[model samples]
Target: MTMDSPIPLAIVGVGKIARDQHLPSISRTPAFALRAAVSRNAEVDGVQNFTDIEACLAARPDVKAVALCLPPEPRFAAAITALEAGCHVLLEKPPGATLGETDVLADLAREKGVTIFATWHSRFAPAVQPAKAFLADRAIRKVTITWREDVRRWHPGQGWVWEPAGFGVFDPGINALSILTEILPDEALLRAARLEVPENAATPIGVTMTMGIAGGGYEIDADFDWRQEGPQTWEIAAETDGGLMSLTGGGKTMAVDGKVVSDEPEAEYDGIYKRFADLIEAGESDMDMRPLRLVADACLLGRRVAVEPFHE
Candidate 1:
């Protein structure tokens, strides 16, 4: 493709997130042209569909970029294939099943001179950068996160969420961590954690964590649960020397000192694709592993408490 033309792109995985977020964002972003898709059981109309990534890549050599929307467990191999074929890659949140695998992908991308973006969609939320600006000059004293949502309403019949490496409640909790890592002036390190795992599941359904700022003067406490039956809650509040800044509605709204400062509609995926286009143009990669590292630390240093089994 020419520099003035939109980048030819392919999307792998046509699941709910791909349908809801990625496809729509790509449609609106003029920098990318959807050329193909790869999915075992799903297809997008008006686009060439393949049953596998290799077939898609081989058939569409002109497609210079790919977005992987599959689960983290299976993303590494696809990312490797895309990068090896000299294609820019945009990975969904949490990048891969492990930090090491993401690192390998990053190295391969660098070697191949292609861009690989391990995106945290929450960081692209409208209110996040505003909150980051608000906290940039203040001394944060404490942070509290409450991210509780009903899995049945959001995930529906997705049983892989309870499997090992699926990340359970942390699937949502990492969003908060991503925001924290973006906005905080200092690195946040995990101190201790408690994980409430379902008796029959391999992942935790509930978690409580304590983290300390690397610069030493503040602490963060977070509670995550996947069993809220009614109205869901996704909020993060930080008490700084300036005032209390609150980010609610999953970073769609922000309030400081109990006053609403920023409120806007969700456009995270759009922002993500915009950034990806920019990265491809600049020949750079954006992959922040802090959020995933915190999750790994939580699992490593946490105390597991087996709770009642969860059923769909």
Candidate 2:
């Protein structure tokens, strides 16, 4: 097939992530072309750009796929629109604000014979595959995660993150859950949780949760905070057979028995694009909502706590 005949892909919500990760990865991958980008106030160098998705779709009907990098609140509508337009969709993390909405999109994609990839980019981290292999047969007794970072450093002046529908701390927290679920042998459930919302913000700035898994009862205690002053830490340590397994630096490094096993530079989004290409070639869809489901459940069941107001 010719290059022009390749899968035409579009990107919605051309925000920081879309420019930083998605665009670079898509450019390097052969399976897709940056046919169009839809955003209210951004434009690509050469590819077609639109202020709205409908305009893009109408102008470029051959676009077979859309990658949604919008905030979780408005993701469902764009995803549904893409699916209805006979295009496969790849959604950013926290697929939708509620699990029910994502479920509907999944079903609609199936009915439309189009793929819906609810991507958890963290799961594609370099160390995650090895971490999953190391703990496959071991008995996981307990797991602890510390995911703390300065929101301003990572998110910059993105005001939407503190809004009611933005999911705030859970945004990064859900990434940890995604990796946990992928490495765990059995499915887990949220046992208890505490959320600390800023007095003036609609979303929580900090969260702590305990999760329990079936079959021998593995436990996971997770902490997410946006007030870290010094170095950011994204660590997951588990007490398992043979010794302790720890994945640190957000899956960029791994250790067993305090001995370094895997430490590599990050290429998570590159792997994601490769996988998307593979899925398209195989005419398959890869959508897993387990991680997002856990987040929604936590929101619904978690205890609310009041914290001091956060200011930018």
Candidate 3:
């Protein structure tokens, strides 16, 4: 669609993220117009709302694209419905529950000639690209990621996060992985991982992993926990031949050798929507699965330690 005439877009799952980020970004972006919403328990004002994706697609035939913001477990089916209906699709972080499901969706998108974007919103942080550019030519010696937050503060009553495939701590941990994957010049390969799962929960509440570059020069150590209180930490640092490069504030700020280079307020979702527009305009899909793959690897290779039961 032309810039002057924005593409009619619908959002499936008008939950926390939809209300907090997607709606605001959509309102500001000229590339898309909010046309409809599909949510079983929520609705977007000033837009057509449907309780089911099928009903939304059947009714809002004019909608050219849809953003799936639901939990990973149920996202694949909603994305399939959107792609099958000839609508470009945007998938929220972690893509789908399984890597196989994402591949299937990609194949279907290709068959339907529709753009499908598996987005890692953290990668869109303002300082991320600059960090990537800085690290492109430097020899990375070691990378450290410390991502800790209180799930109760971020997720609140979201019980689905502790279920099977809910990802638990990995849900936020994958954000760090996305930034890591984006900034590293070479592919990062997981070496070992330890997961601390609550005795009563299916997913881990904390994760510690070691990874190395595919070319075998550098190493990465990542620690993710959902037990931090008061001030949260989302920081990544890379020690390189030149100096130490730090990305903090969830990638909104960056520093090199203790000197700040780029520090900006968070507007990652805005960038995400803009990139989605660009991908649709170019008739292409961006379904990077590296971050998700790393999580999958952890699940496959990680040593699970049963910790105390987690209570909200």
For residue 183, what is the lDDT in candidate 1? 90
What is each predicted model's overall lDDT from 0 to 1? Answer: 0.94, 0.88, 0.94
Tell me how far the alpha carbon of residue 23 in candidate 2 is from the true structure, in angstroms, after superposition.
Answer: 0.5
Instruction: Flag regions of model 3 displaced more than 4 Å.
Output: 1-4
Q: Model 2, range 1-312, lDDT digits (tens) per residue?
A: 123456889999988898899999998888888899999998888889898888899999989899999998888888888999999898888788888888899899889987788888999888898999998989887899999999989888888988977999989989999999998878989888999999998899999998897654778899999999889999999998768999998998889999989988898898888777777666678878888878877888999999999988
Better of 1 and 2 by TM-score: 1
TM-score of 1: 0.98
* Candidate 1 minimal-lDDT segment of 10 residues: 1-10
Query: Per-residue lDDT of 63-173 in model 3, one digit per residue for the tens?
Result: 999999999999988998899999999999889999999999999999999999999999999999999999999988999999999999999999999999899999999
Tens digits of per-residue lDDT for model 1, 1-312: 235989999999999999999999999999999999999999999999999999999999999999999988988899999999999999998798998998899899999999999999999889999999999999888999999999899898999889987999999999999998999888899999999999999999999999997657988999999999999999999999889999999999999998999998899999999999988888889988999999999999999999999988
- When 1 and 2 are scored with lDDT, the better candidate is 1
lDDT of 2 at 46: 89
Q: For model 2, what is the alpha-carbon lDDT of residue 290?
A: 89
Select the stronger candidate by lDDT from 1 and 3: 3
Candidate 3 lDDT trough over 10 residues, lowest sum: 1-10
What RMSD does each model have against the real structure? 1.1, 1.7, 1.0
* Cα-based lDDT at residue 150, candidate 2: 90
Look at candidate 1 and give me any clashing residue pairs.
Answer: none
How do the predictions measure up, each by TM-score?
A: 0.98, 0.96, 0.98
